[model samples]
Each structure stands twice: as C-alpha cells, then as structure tokens.
Target: MSRARAIGCDGGGSGARLALVWDGLRHEVCGGPANVTSDFAGAVAEVSGLLHRAAQLAGVSLEDLRGVPAHFALAGVVDERVATRVAAALPLEGVVEEDRRAAVRGALGERPGHVAGIGTGSYLARQGPDGFETIGGHGLVLGDEASGAWMGRALLKAVLAVEDGVEPATALTRQIAEEMGGVSGIVAFAAEAGPSDFAALAPRLLDAKTDSAARHIIVAGADYIARGLLALGWKEGGAICLIGGIGGKYADFLPTQMQKALVGAEGSALDGALALAMEQDG
Candidate 1:
C-alpha cells in the first residue's frame, strides 16, 4: 500500500469498485454500495473496509496507503461539505466527487461526445475541453428522469391512478396491484422505498411486451432523455454513448437520427476513476 501511487473508486447505489495502482500495475477490489446520501456512515465504512481488503490482497497493510491520493467517483454526493467529511474518513488522502463525471469520461474518454447514464439515477452530459456539462441527477425526489427509480415510482403512481379510476388499468396495472396486495400494499411499499428499493420494481416495466401503460411510462422517460440530450447541445450525428443499466433501452424511443449517433462505452466508471487518480498523482 505504501508503494501505491494512486487510488481510484467508482461507487454507486449497487456497489463500489476500487483500483490500487503501484508502478504500472493496478489491483482492483469490489465492495458494497457507497452512495453517501443513502447511508453516510455505511458508505464510509464500506470504503474503509474495501481499502483494507485491497491492502491485504496486495500483501500490505492499511498503514501503507497513508498518503495515497484517491479519486472517488461516488453516487449521492451533492454537498461539498459532505464530500469533505467523507474524505476525512478514508484510509488515505482522497477526494469525493459526483459519479456523473466518471460516467461521461468512461464512456467517451477525451473525445467530444454526449453521455446518457440511466441506472438507479439519471444524468445527461456533454464532454468537452472544459470538462463535463451536465443536467439532471438530482436524485429520486427532485429529478433523475428516465432513471430506473423514476420509472419504478411512475409505474406505482400509475397503478394508483388506475385505482382512482382516472387512468386506464391495463394488464400491467392489474398484475402489479394483485402482487402487491392491491391498493394498500402498493401504498405501503412506496412509503418505505428508497431509490434502490424502488428501482427493483423497474424490471417488470423493462420486460413488458404487450403492456400499454408500461410503454407509456417508459415513453415519458424517453421524452426526458430527448430533452436532456438537446439541452446538452446534441444535434444529428453527435456521438452519444449510453451508460448504465437502463440507458440503451431509451434509444428506440429517441428520434432515429439520435439513435444513429449512439456508440458503445469505451470503458466503465472504474476506468475513468483510475485514470483520474493517475492524473492526480502526476
């Protein structure tokens, strides 16, 4: 760990990835979710444990990573003061930044392009010489349109609308209502659901084939995707790399010209984080 030159982390609602660099070699480790907003102390503890495990995996101790410069790309870090506090809990000298930048970097590298990452959260960004210009990713309550969490929450709300006799109750609504024990159960689930909890409900919507209501919800999310893309200055033929679990699903909803501009990711957030950590070392 003392021989470590840099540390890089890609952390989100699902999990965390850490890369320890020594000379030209990189040792990577995986750990629990590190979304600081959902569980601050837990996130710090998970990171601390991962670094300790990484040190052990490298046949060293946590003490050896004393001054390593770590660049952490973590979800749920909106407050600068909170970032500073998270940094203080790390085993090494580190910086905490929102996960969106890493998504953009990993998807496009230094090449100018746009990125639409839609997983538990959503964000759209344009990568350029001045760094990333982004929109959305305000988390579930205020924003994150087209995200898994958003889609899931929308589905439940639509089901409730069906209960109220305002919206049509398609087969999808009936199925969900039945499974959740009708109106009462759906309401209960919503009451306690966090982003990841709500996101777990998106797969049914994702897997829909003949459900009109499901399509409607997804289409609305796609509309936001189009808006976010345009707001970031996307035009016909502009490269847009989709990232995360739900990003590719929206391509069909966007205009055909925009779909034509879609490209596969060059790397992942972990790669971007490691690259940034290396940059900090230099």
Candidate 2:
C-alpha cells in the first residue's frame, strides 16, 4: 500500500506557500497574494495553482492528489462562513483555518506560548492547556495594530501632520514627501491604497535614520504589539515568538519586558499546516 500524502498551505496578504509531504519527503511551491476576505476568488485561484505545482514537484500526479489530504491556513478567514466559501471554491479535500492558529502551532508546537504575527496584517495568539485564543486580527481599518500596514499608515499620517502644521516638519517627513512627490503624490497613493500598499511603506519606516518622528513611530508600533501580548495573557518571562515579514524587525524596539519574553519559533506556518494535515489523516 502507498503511504498517505498530505499538503500544507500558508496564505497571507503578500503571497501563498505550499508544502507537500509524500513518501517521507517534502516539496515546496510559491504562489501570489491570498487574502481570502479581500478577494476570495483570487485567493482560491492562487492556492489552487500552488497546490498543483507542489504536487508536481513532489512527483505526484494531479489525479493522485485526490487522495491526499490538504490543509490551508489563510489570512482574512475570520469565520466559518468564509472558510466554507473558500473550501467550496477550492478543488481539494481539507480544512481551512485562520492564519493566526497556524502561526501559533508553527511557532510553539503543542507547548503553551504566545505568538505575535506582524506582517502586512497583525494578530496576537496564545496557546494554553485549554486551547488557542487570538486577538486583534481585524484588518487595517479596525485593528492590526503594530502591523506593517499600521506602520505605513502611521508614516503617511506623520507626513500629513507635518504638512498641515499640526506637527513640526522633520527630516523623515521631508524624505517621505520627496519620495511620494510632495503632498499631491501622497494623496494619490492614499486614494486607492490597500493593506499591502501601506505595508510597502514599512521598510522605509524601518530604514529611516536618526529622526525623532521615525523613532516615535517605531516606539508606538512596538508598544502596540506589547499591549496585544499582554492582553493575550502573555507574561514577562513567558515564551513569545514573533512571526511574519516584519515580526523580527520590531524585536529591538520592543519594551524591555517583551524583549525578555521573545523566543525563536519552532517552525514555520507551513509546518503547522502539515501538522494539521497529518492530524486529519490520522
């Protein structure tokens, strides 16, 4: 009899990744942006494409994928209704879970700990003896504090404040204005900017040199993360793994208390997806 096979998918605002496990070996593939809540069809298409690519790389035929269980941990999957929609759209047999759950399992495994995912979208998750609990993944408009999008939005706000005389013009503001082609350019960008667009500004915020405005933004971002951690019952000396594109960048800026709680992740989200698939297979 052939050994059972499974595929694990991790989808975020930036992109989607796949890991296929078969015959004791693993294969990986990448796909485009997949925020299910924002664009369900697009996200499903991206995930489907990556799954096929992963199957091929694993030397498994498309027909064989029918028997292989798959699990997807996706961003923007807030409720079962969305998960159901996503599941129905995909041509695979598996489960869909919130991205934060995958991050927690990937970062802490079965052990009790806390995770702060600070990518284009941010969320705080904690795993205890009871189970997993999450907070603050409400997207950019409502929440996602300390996330890349949040930082980017803050940068734009700072620039506008300087322009309107609400705050003194700083070097960072001037640089941003110059980069965005002055006030007009900033307005143009904001008109149609999405979470990813705002997240794109995070690198610039992180790279700004010796400016108080930039420093203030960084400090505020860190504080937001720290607050989320505390709200999730994180303690001063407990394990907290920072996960996501911008997760590590905030480490240095975190308050002394949070810094001490920070620890390395046990695995990536893909690993968590694989673990979930394996569990279902069992």
Candidate 3:
C-alpha cells in the first residue's frame, strides 16, 4: 500500500498556514505576510516555502511530496480565474478549493448545509456531498460588509464622530483604541491590514458592543450576515455553522432569529483542513 500524506494550506491576508496530516498525526508549517490571490508571485513563493517547511518537519522531501495530494485553502481566492492563478502557484498534485470552502468544509467536517464565515472578511456558502456553492464574500472593499473590517471601519467612523464632536467617544471606543494601541496606531495599522487582522479585532468590537455606536455597527454587521445567510437559502431547519473570527467569537451576540438558524459543528477551519488532508482519493 502506498503511504498517504495530506497537505492543506490556508493563505489569508494576514498570514498563511500549511497543515500536514499523515498516519493520524497533524503538523503545521507557517509562512508570512502574503495573500496569494492579491500577490501572485508572493503567493507562489510563500506557499512553496510553507510546503518545503512542512516536508522538512515531517521528515518528507520534495520527492516525497510529488506523489502525495494537497488540498489548498486560500483567502481572496474568488471565482475560477483566481483559483486558476493560485493553482499555477502550487506545485503539489491534488485538489484545489477556495478558502471559504476549505473553511466550511473544515468547519462542517465535509458535511453539507449552509455556513457563514464572518471574520476579517465575510462569506456565506452552502456545501453538500455533491459540492459547494457561494452566496457572498467580495472582500472588505466591495462585500464583507458584516465582517470584522466592517466593524473596524464603523469603529473608525465612530471615532471620527467623536473627533467632530458629534458625540463623545464611548468608553468602549476608547478602550478599543487603547487596546489597538491608539487612534493613530489604528489608522496606521488599518492602512495595511489584511482580512485576518480585521477578523482578529472582532473581540475589541465585541467588547464595546454595549455602546450605542458599537452596538449599531455590530448589529449592522450581524444584519448583513443574516441577510447573506438567508440569501444562501439557510433555513431554520438546516444545519448552519458560523465560522471565522467574528462568527465563532460573537455567537452569543447574534440576533435570536439568527441563533435559531444554526445547529452545531464538529470542528473548525483548522480541523476541516486536517480532515480534508486525511481523505483519500478514489
């Protein structure tokens, strides 16, 4: 029997993760500051480096990787064109799936139903054994209106409001700014933040959800998310698992109506990647 090895990679805007699974054991290799969809060469190089590292750690060589299959999950990889571009960047032979799918697959344990991923960015998708279909996830600039970036942007607007003397900066806003370093720091950091960074800030926003402005923004994001989920055909009867930073962390804050929409889950994106790697090709 040919020994099998599974490789899974999730490349977000903030960072990249390479997960390797073999013989019921899982190992991870990380690579930098790259978004494959946005930076073609950088994506290729980062992914290559991650793969090389994983192989090294696993005591496997490049020659060993030539035969094993990889399941790659990448952020900002939307549509077939983006997938094709990333496919070229990866050297391993196997299947390619969008980060959202990978995340959902990971989150849902390859099961079916509707899943909403709200993190630095937001995306809603449906998956079944047959395949997966996307509802929304256009990134912060266009879509992702209900995501962490959306909240961060709203928080910034609130800060602007405070600056303009429209209203005092709430305690929550002050705390968020302080925790984030400072107003100037947030400005500087946001200027170059990736999806993961924005998602990572969900906690700060949640902390301030009590304030009027923070509440407004968080509810607005949840509303957008709920709308996206409904658009994807998520029904109260179906299984709906919320993934991503905001989704997982702020589960309690979601409207009761939205809460009733979800069932339960087996694992997370990380687990999903491990499971994806474990499956053998027919």
Candidate 4:
C-alpha cells in the first residue's frame, strides 16, 4: 500500500491537528488536546488515534502509515528528554519538538522577527539568520506566564482575594464567584483543574472591559509577554507576530510601540509543522 510521504501534527492544550501529505494530495484532521508533559500516556494515544482516523479518511490502510516520518509539534514537550520520551512512545517514526519552532516558523517564516504564542500555554521565540531561539513555555506550573491558563489562574486568585477581603469585589469577581458556586466551589475547581480547564475561564478576562480585576490580570499577562520578548533580544521596530487564541488579545494591552511593530502571521503553526515534515522526509 502506498502511504503518505510525510505527516505533520500541531498539538496544544486546547486541541491537536494532524496532516498527511502524499504527492499533491493531503488529508487533515483535528483531535482532542495533547499535552505530552501534562499527560504523556494520554497524549501518545491521542496522536495514534488521529493517525488511524486520518488513514481511514484518506482511503488508506492503517498499516500504510508505517515508516512515514512525522514532525509532531506538541505543547508541554519543552526539552530533549521529553522529546525522546514522546518519540519513543508514539506508534509513528518521527521527531518530536516543542511547539514553539512551528509557531515561530509559521508566523514569521525566515523574516527576522519575534513570535509570541499565548494559548493554553505560552512560548516566545525570535527567528533570524541564526535560526530560532526561544524562552518560556515551561508549562503551567512554572512558566507560561502570558498564557490563557495563566490569566484563568490569576482570575481565580483575585476571587480568593475578594473572599478574604484583601481585595474589593468587582462585577466580574462577583459574577464568576456566583457561577462557580462561591469560594468553596472555586477552590474545588482549582484543585482538579488542568491547563485547558483553567484556560477555559480566560475568555471572561478577555472581554471584561470595565472589570478592574480582569484588567489587572490581562495587564499582568501583557507585561510578562513584553518582558519575555525583551529578554529574547527584541528591539524597537522589530516585527512581532502574535499567534494562538489568547495571543492576539494582548494587542490592546501591549505598549504602543509594540503594537506599532506588530505584524500579521504568514501562516499557522500547523503549516509550519507540515513544512518541517516534508523537509525532513526529503
């Protein structure tokens, strides 16, 4: 059975996408979240499932997927040790890397610039002639400062502050508290919350125009994004491409100079993944 020549996947906290290429034909599919660091076993199973489904949809045998190389860009795969684990566990033959390069390559291409990806997690990268260098995206526990999960976690902290009388309640805090069944419920939710679960609550902060508490969280996230970029050698007038669900939302909070230097994305992270896969196969 003739199979795909190359396969590409972009998996993050929110969801995962897979694409297979053969000659000029292509097939793509979306699956559940795959965060290797957070849930290693589950993430591998999810990628395998996507490949089976992709095979069926493309009218190819599942066995045909054998030996095909994949460039899998997954969140929570922050280092070589984790990458080795992911590569060894997967059913496919491929190289697994942190999702930052794909996002940076897809967003900025070869153009000298910076990219800030803020979705379920956060990663900042600078792409230049020297190739790509990145920072952050250490994951929810330590880094991922400007990510959706960070904003969500920050919001819950603010609610707790209001409950303890350390901070005044705003309409946003009161509303969120009521929705989550008061302080006790909020604590329970946090106890079991994963990155996506926390990230789900970030939308409230994104749309809260007059909510001081929400603004505070958003501003703090923006501050981290700016600082992280500076640490990565960002300069004035350097093109900064923001990607991901929460990435573009920070535009309003960014310094006026950054906003001016902002540039539109050339493509998506998945596009970058596919390009890398084909390059590796060749």
lDDT tens digits by residue: candidate 2, 31-101: 88899988988999999898888778887776788867778999889899999989988888789987777
lDDT of 2 at 2: 22
Q: Estimate each model's TM-score.
A: 0.87, 0.87, 0.78, 0.82
Cα displacement (angstroms), candidate 3, residue 127, comes to 1.3
Off by over 4 Å in 4: 1-5, 38-42, 52-69, 89-92
Report how far residue 165 has shifted in candidate 3, in Å. Answer: 7.3
| Better candidate by lDDT, 2 or 3 | 2
The local distance difference test score of each candidate is 0.85, 0.85, 0.72, 0.87
Global lDDT for candidate 4?
Answer: 0.87
RMSD of each: 3.0, 2.9, 4.1, 3.7
| By TM-score: ranked, best first | 1, 2, 4, 3
State the lDDT of candidate 3 residue by residue for 7-63, as single tens digits.
Answer: 778777778888876665677878775565678688778888888888788887877
Cα deviation at 278, candidate 1, in Å, is: 1.9
Give the TM-score comparing model 3 with the true structure, all chains together: 0.78
Candidate 2 wrongly placed segments (more than 4 Å): 1-4, 62-69
